[model samples]
Target: MKHPSQNSSPSLDNVYRIYWLLVALFVGRMGDLYVLLSRRASTLRTYAGDTSLPGGKRDPQDHNIELTARREAFEEIGLPLDPQKVPLLCILEPFLAGNSLIVTPVVVLILDNTLRPILNTPEVTSLFSHPLISFLHSEPPFATEPEMLEMKYHTYDDVSSSTRPGKVRLHRFMTGRETGGTKPIFGLTAAILIRVATIGYARAPDFEVNAPGQPSQEQRIARALKHDPIFREAAALEGIDPGRIPEPSALRRQVRTRDKRRARSKL
Candidate 1:
């Protein structure tokens, strides 16, 4: 018998030298896609308070991104998924961080979700899950209003005693959380989920059914840019025009004017 786990698949190398990373978007049998995110512990340096997905730099012994994703999931949150049932559905485009790291998101449908995560307190304080659809909705929950996420970072050279501005990006969008989940997902994660929803479901995951009132193509895009701060750079990395990036204010206008809709996105 050929075990599915041993089957070959594409993945980012685990040499540990490549800046590549992997995140798990685990979907359960009930069709509820869960984003396994971790809250950085107080001791961490970067993104100490911000919530991000569960995955990290690969161990040199890890074979591929799939192994890296699973290994990271367990190490961070104790999500022990069976390799036989959990298959990588697709690998989203690599995202570039402000620090120049390329991160890839690996989607896996978990046949089971009973395992509990053992928290690595120094690295991750806790972990949580939110339905994937929360990020797709257009109204009060996800895209209620236009919000600006202007991130300004600076780097200091210890030797020269000089400071230089790092990445300057503005993220404008609505909050994509519901219930008690106040922690919104990072911008790049939202981009990956949007692609997954459109490709796999043929519709945005914002709701159970698509209707006339749903966000138009332009509006949906505007929302995505708002969530992801570095999407523009990511697109440029793929050889797309940076001008295709939409403005945050324009997206706000579209969302506010629900009575009118654009037939197609301008950008």
Candidate 2:
């Protein structure tokens, strides 16, 4: 399944270069499908006061992203993830964060739901989780369509002038049963979850299909992004021309037709 936003990410050439050293892991409880998440410490500067999956920068001791994710999960939450029990589901499409770090999301499914997260204070302030069904249900928890929120950055030597008044689509994976201030997920996290819901949980994805007749999944995703400012802005950030931001309608149709052709071929 295609992720929420991979096509039109911004160019981070001028931004600070941290390399591919960071990773996040979606740790799912096998039976209930609840994914673990941590609330970033208020003391931190970057992505401060945001909720995110468990992960950290890749250490020199780590060989790959999988190791990095496992290590980070343990360090951040003290969740001892047995490599044999908590199996890696997939490596999501890598993306560049606003901070200029290229991040890789490692999806892992754990055997039990009895998770007692010990937050590594200062890095993580708290812990919480919502079921995958909440996102999949599409009625109460998360909207049928992703929500867009305006973004603004204090222009530093690294930031471009165009990024001002930046607007991005926020993925609100609210727990229908819980009430409080909304904890919205954005950018790479949103993109990864959208794909995870559809692929890992066997749930219908969240997107809008513009075609009149029955439209394929590809067409739906393309149409959804066409209306998503985040997608356009991200692509533009990548230094792609404005003309290349929103994908053309004809190309969406072409992709839909080709998908059908491949299906028929297999049949």
Which candidate number has the best TM-score? Answer: 2
Tens-digit per-residue lDDT, 71-169, candidate 2? 888888877768666677777665545533456677776655465677789888877776655545434443332232222111112222243222333
**Candidate 2 stretches greater than 4 Å from native:** 1-31, 113-115, 141-168, 175-182, 209-265
Relative to the unseen true structure, what is the C-alpha lDDT of residue 199 in candidate 1, on a scale of 0 to 100?
63
For residue 262, what is the lDDT in candidate 1? 50
Candidate 2 is scored at a TM of 0.58
Kindly give the number of clashing pairs for every candidate.
4, 9
User: Whole-model lDDT for model 2 versus the true structure?
Assistant: 0.54
- lDDT minimum window of 10 residues, candidate 2: 152-161
Question: How far in Å is the alpha carbon of 68 misplaced in model 2?
Answer: 0.7
Report model 1's TM-score to 2 decimal places.
0.53
Q: Candidate 1: which pairs clash?
A: 77-117, 172-226, 187-227, 187-228
Count residue pairs with overlapping backbones in model 2.
9
